[model samples]
Target: MELIQEVMIMYCTRNVTEDLVWVGGNDRRLSLFEGVYKVPYGVSYNSYLLLDEKTVLLDTVDKAVGGIFFENIEHTLNGRPLDYLIVNHMEPDHCAMIEDLTRRHPETVIVTNAKVAGMIKQFFNFDIDSKLKLVSEGDELSTGKHNLTFIMAPMVHWPEVMVTYDKTDRIPFSADAFGCFGAINGALFADEVDFYRDYFDEARRYYTNIVGKYGAQVQALLKKASAVEISMICPLHGFVWRRDFADYIAAYDKWSRYEPEKQGVVIAYGSIYGNTENAAEILACRLNELGIRTKMFDVSVVPASEIVAATFEYSHVVFASATYNGGIFVKMEDLLHDLAAHNFQNRTVALIENGTWAAMTAKQTAELLGKCKNLNILEQKVTIKSSVKQAQNEDIDALAKTIAGTF
Candidate 1:
């Protein structure tokens, strides 16, 4: 006699381990992430469900996809009641569905730190104290067969942020430490996709904008993480790192230490007319002629997030802008503010300013870049009067040489 097999349906859910499943969904329809940066490739909200002795759900999804998330949880649980819900980060993108989850599984205990617990109250009017089980650093929560250790990672982008480490699987549920801003379309693990080709830029943008402000905190977390054995990194966003852990860790180390990942030049210019842009193009050509690689971006066109990422990636950065209202161009000023706010450091920067009369952009740009640490502002400031004249070519060449010498 032949037996019939009962096939189970999974709605965008994948298994991380025999007892652990990925119960997260992607937000491809949302135009902006946090109403600030553009996510052209979309983003993912990663949450894992561990079906151990105690069925545990780690983190919730944004309210936009709350329905799909609940469906995923139901399908994965297969009618089993939820025992615990671990809150890694209190950001609404990860905690918007907390009240909904508690309503669905009233018996499930919400686990998090005291600071995050307070944030939960501020964001929502839920009775957190009634169901909250606060865990401190070095605290452990044992589920039937798996044990998770909490590591406090304060100012890792947030004051209440913390990571959960599963001792049995040696996986760290990093809240936002190793996260990126791209949707996981079919491929869930880093090795499953062409990471460098597909998600490297987005990952850099995510890191530089979201967590770049707290490099010291990240360094401290890395030191603490080195003491433990981490084989797999399952962050709250983007792909899971099941292979090449060292490469990713090293990248994070370099990024947190404000070190450039490559030797190249990034030319960012804000031009009202084509004159300023023309000067920028000329400089880029000169840099290329000298065998120095360059990445050029028009500040008015390209997003500031990309420029910030490029500034972090390259060893040299050139800010070329046309004077507007006797000051630096607004878009260029905004980009510089972002770079300084993100604590951009350890790079050689050159200034190129254009003005018909009263050229004050160079001075203003210098003052802005001066706020940053370890920035080597080149002495040769290329000043374009109305347009790039034949006399300025020598100055541009000198500036190019100064920049190339550093490489």
Candidate 2:
């Protein structure tokens, strides 16, 4: 005789508004997000279901959570025919289940822009023209009492990205904007958790690593969004913002302009031996003793993403490295390039170099950092030979004093 084993479900979803429900799901099983950033608390893929006069889904979750997502949708619908499937950002994580959703809801009309329509055709092999309903910026779709206005968000992280404004509810379904990295846990809203204490770091990391390069684009999107009165924000990831969310919007505005959140020093050091790190430690100690906030990391130990995230939040930065073959150390070099590639700029910087023979790291680092935008590199640099010598302690002190003086 054949035996059947009962299937277990692993999913958590919530409701956003009176008629709108959050039918998204989480992926605690995903260790790495985008196969690069480390997601310790995992990540959440958000999608919304609108129980209007006509049923609609804002977006779809990642394929990893598609099963639970579909089940949630099925339960929420309760046999109501899905009328519209709105496509915002066409990233694979958001669009992975596009074909699957269409197959399940055959009567559903796919609503998107012309560029996204092409992308849909590129991503799936279906007769899209028959089900496609193309829209543009300022276009509105009325579903019962709700009127959603589309706002184009080009390269806020993607060219095809767009946000929807629910004028009826004063909610903006922001696509990838104001998004963070972490599963929503059991809570669905930002006010439900101590966001700053528990999730702020991950949010910074997510913004810096993924969307850091396109600050200009983000600024444009923000300017456009300012014209609309946003009461609540529904991003495609992490927590929803319904209450006490002004600070969150302010954060996006500041970050998009490449402004630091607070006045603190982030010291990232690269050392083959312990000498360079020792020098870095001495400087950090002096800064702390001077009543300045400081965060220190070894480039070899901490991943570049974390360091970059910290640097993005702080007003000042310090780089210490031991010369490697007459150049900056490999890890340190990679980290600097990573920061530069992400358009990291607009902060005060100091440097420290250590070498037995050729001490050229500080100059090289300064030159590389100089190529970026509006960075204030200090004239004072600390130089160490083998270790933190008693005489070089004065140099460390001087650098620390200079860094503190800026604040």
Candidate 3:
């Protein structure tokens, strides 16, 4: 059947090549691109209906869209009644409709792991008494024609998270794996979208912003996923992956490893005035002249989240800032504080500071570097005399050398 492109509606239809029904959401939030926190492409709250002899519903969307989600559920079930609802991730965005679902289909069993059950109780405050079926790692539950193998993915962003694999369908119900933040109108498979150019960036942005802190755990999950025979990935967000599934896995693999996108130097400056920005631009030019690709961000203009995300994607990060009241700008401090908390890994950092009398940024910025894990700090520091000088040309040259050598 043909799919329609309408906004803010949840509907259901069977995958042309698979037995699973796409239900739940493909709604877009208009406010999703208003600012730094807004993920421009929005997101999809995906759920699935897999029918054999027994039926399984993968996940649900937010309570705000619970009505539409249930509408999709009703349309797909056609009064046969759902047998199971698989709670992949316990995050409210995907699990908010669980309560309503349970109330609607009182006989439907909730399938999840021990940790997830705890979260369900904690989040919903319901004594689900006897309605829970707990599965652990490598555990398989059979429903006649199809078998679901549960793989525990702790800290693939959350502790209670697990992925469901239907071996018969060769599909992995990847709770949050291979997910992006866009709402698809009519598309089902990822290959239907321009994933190479657009979706990949959204996926990376999602990973860096949400799951970057759990890089090690993601790597472990990726390893586990690699061992499975998966032809499709039905994540809780964005498009479903049927064809080119390996590419998404490979993309996640690279992201978890903190691999650089390209040989580029990111010159991030926290400028109090135009002074520090001037230094950054000059340094970028020098790096460019030396055949080194450079991307510059004014920490004031670009968000701290974006900076951290880009920093993880670059081999070299150079921070330029003006000292204010004997310290680096509050914004810069906040950025450094966040970077430290996330254990900013796998990058070389260089510092540039400008201050009239106190000149505290160089030392303070360098001190902030100590908070990050696996961070390599270049030995040379660029100190400005409240302004740029001809002698400062050597500092840019030195910065270029540091980046070239590290990359």
* Candidate number achieving the greatest TM-score relative to the actual structure: 1
What digit string (tens of lDDT, one per residue) describes model 1 on residues 319-384?
Answer: 999999999999999999999999999999999999998777888999988889999988879999
The top-ranked prediction according to lDDT is: 1
Clashes of each: 0, 0, 1
Q: In model 3, where do residues sit more than 4 Å from their true spots?
A: 1-17, 30-36
What TM-score quantifies how close candidate 2 is to the native fold?
0.95
| TM-score of predicted structure 1 | 0.97
Better of 1 and 2 by TM-score: 1
Instruction: Give the C-alpha lDDT of model 3.
Output: 0.80
Give the candidates in order of TM-score, highest first.
1, 2, 3
Per residue, candidate 2 scores C-alpha lDDT tens digits across 200-234 of 88888988898988999988988988898877899
Off by over 4 Å in 2: 1-12
Q: State how far residue 252 of model 2 sits from its true place (Å).
A: 1.2
Q: Which run of 10 residues does model 3 get worst, by summed lDDT?
A: 30-39
Candidate 3 lDDT tens digits, 1-407: 99998755446565635567887675566444323455656667888888778988988887756777888888788788789988889998899988888888988999999998998988885557579999899889898889889988998888989999898877888888777877776787777878878777667777777778887899998888778787778888778877766666776787788776766878888887688899899889888888888778887877777777777777888889888877888888888887776657778888898888867887788777876667788888788877899888787788778777776
Q: Lowest-scoring 10 consecutive residues by lDDT in candidate 1?
A: 7-16
